[model samples]
Target: MSEAFCLELYKDKVVVSYYAEKFHGRKTANGERFNMYDMTCAHKTLPFNTIIRVTNYANGKSVDVRVNDRGPFVAGREVDLSKGAAVKLDMIKTGTAKVKIHIVKMGANTKQSAVSAAKAQKIPITPSKGTAAKSQSAKKLVLKSGQLYDIQLGSFSDENNAREYAKKISRAKFKNVALQKSGGNTRVSVIKVDGKDVPSVVKQLEAKGFGNAFVKERKK
Candidate 1:
């Protein structure tokens, strides 16, 4: 499999939904009879039988599920869980939830399955040579500098206030939001960004009512 394909599988900010009675007993993409009561899930490109831990971001409830089918089929949604798995995460009432996915083990069909699924979805199989070269150059530049940028959302003297604000930011669907504590201050910030992207990220936060957001640079 191409490096680009492998990297895409690990990208974050996954939103998931569940399917239950409607799909139960149907033949899945992997040729198995769907069982809504079983701990199985459908992913766009994960290989059949791959195991993953799905954690609900809001409540911290998590469940281990095996990939047995393909897709949530909707744009902006990543994985589709079985009713059983969704129940385990206490997300049945919401129908859809923001979650974190951690790969537990890769399945045997990793290469073949991912490639075929990507093709079906009309996604590029590999990056163009120029794109790949540019990406490598960018990585080298970051490594050499050992510097990173953050968009600070807020800083509070109280830890509880900082955590509550962080949760509020997360519920707004912002990516990479986190809380950091140092001394008596707790800061809520978005921790993933290139220096050049700081302005745009700050603009996004401002639009969502975080008008005090500012950029901070840190050396690794």
Candidate 2:
């Protein structure tokens, strides 16, 4: 159930990136006015309002960020920190960091770490080809391959608009992210998973206020 999923905190080693300051004042997927100076983050699947600890490996710096937006539209990146987070991690120059993330708490519940650290699975975060390494702490969690129900996040008359939306959807943090260019529309790419996961995925998106999220059959 959604409530149960929210109660469990997820831990993962993911390639972390930052949101552009240009979107600082724009509306987030949760209908929030984004402020890049705040210590916030954008995650794909983590429940909105969740707080996480992000540790930057390059500088050995870490910071706590609240999940307020979604994305890192490109693959291999799991979390997108606001400028303030990037500054805390000293990642403003390289623009990316290999880091560890711990879900510190769920909304109104500060006890997630007490349970999550003991029970949360550490999913692998794929780094750039230059930085890829083996993870021995936990095995990866993946949906079984089958007839996956693909969801079209958006279709835009302008290419930039589509790409922008795709980036936001990427914050959902699923590895099988995709994009297709046809004439003008760009949508969040599809993933191949058993049809059963569709409802759950949609529900998570809905919980975050993405009411238009839906699933459709993939084209062969």
Candidate 3:
């Protein structure tokens, strides 16, 4: 599925952002330590080790980056580049750019292969009964009112880190900065609004240095 998706995205223009220096040395989704100097990138669904050529539309500069992690997570964005790749494309100052992507090599880590490997080891693919019950309990908290959109700043595993980040955002004069715990992670969101205002809220958050800010829909 991802192989076909990659093929279809070839030569298509995509919005991309670069990782901040604070993320250097952190463990990536593939269990590799992220080095900002490496020629690597992240895509939400691309197989690990997939190599893709990204060309900046404005400057015509190109860099071949290996897919080593997952996310940009925000809507309207496709790839997240390392510092080296961003420097190569001359996008450090601008922070984000429109680029064209061409898959140079397809990776071996496909969904089907993973499922087959799990089946060979007799690993369970479905959730456990307890997990399903927990999910049901969580769903009971959902509001029955109309949907609301939240401009999320970030998510963290530590409650202290989440609170500190939320405070920082609040100090910046961004109103309604709040934290919510879900799925063992704490999420800091700026404000909730109607669906029609999501784009403007996202733009404001991005201008305030929250480039990865995305929308989260919830019943209100």
Maximum-TM-score candidate: 2
lDDT of 2 by residue, 32-84 (tens): 78899999988654556887888776777878899776564565667889998
Cα RMSD (Å) per model? Answer: 16.6, 11.9, 10.8
Instruction: Report every candidate's CA lDDT.
Output: 0.65, 0.60, 0.66
lDDT of 3 by residue, 1-220 (tens): 5343444245457789999689899877676889999999986445678888888999988888998876665556778999999999999999999998877676785533322222221111122222111111123122112446566666655566567667766776778889988887677887666555455555566555454444455655
- Candidate 3 lDDT at 132 equals 13
Q: Model 1 over residues 1-220: C-alpha lDDT tens digits?
A: 7222233234245688999998789877666899999999987446678877777888988788998876554546778899999999898889998886666666885544432333332211122222111111122122112346666655555466567667877887888988888766677889966655555665566556553444555656
Candidate 2, lDDT over the whole model: 0.60
Which portions of model 1 show Cα errors greater than 4 Å? 1-11, 111-220
Write down the lDDT that model 3 would get.
0.66
Q: Would you estimate the TM-scores of all the predictions? A: 0.49, 0.53, 0.49
lDDT of 1: 0.65
Cα RMSD, model 2 = 11.9
Cα lDDT, model 1, residue 16: 89
Q: Give the Å error, residue 175, model 2.
A: 16
lDDT of 3 at 76: 62
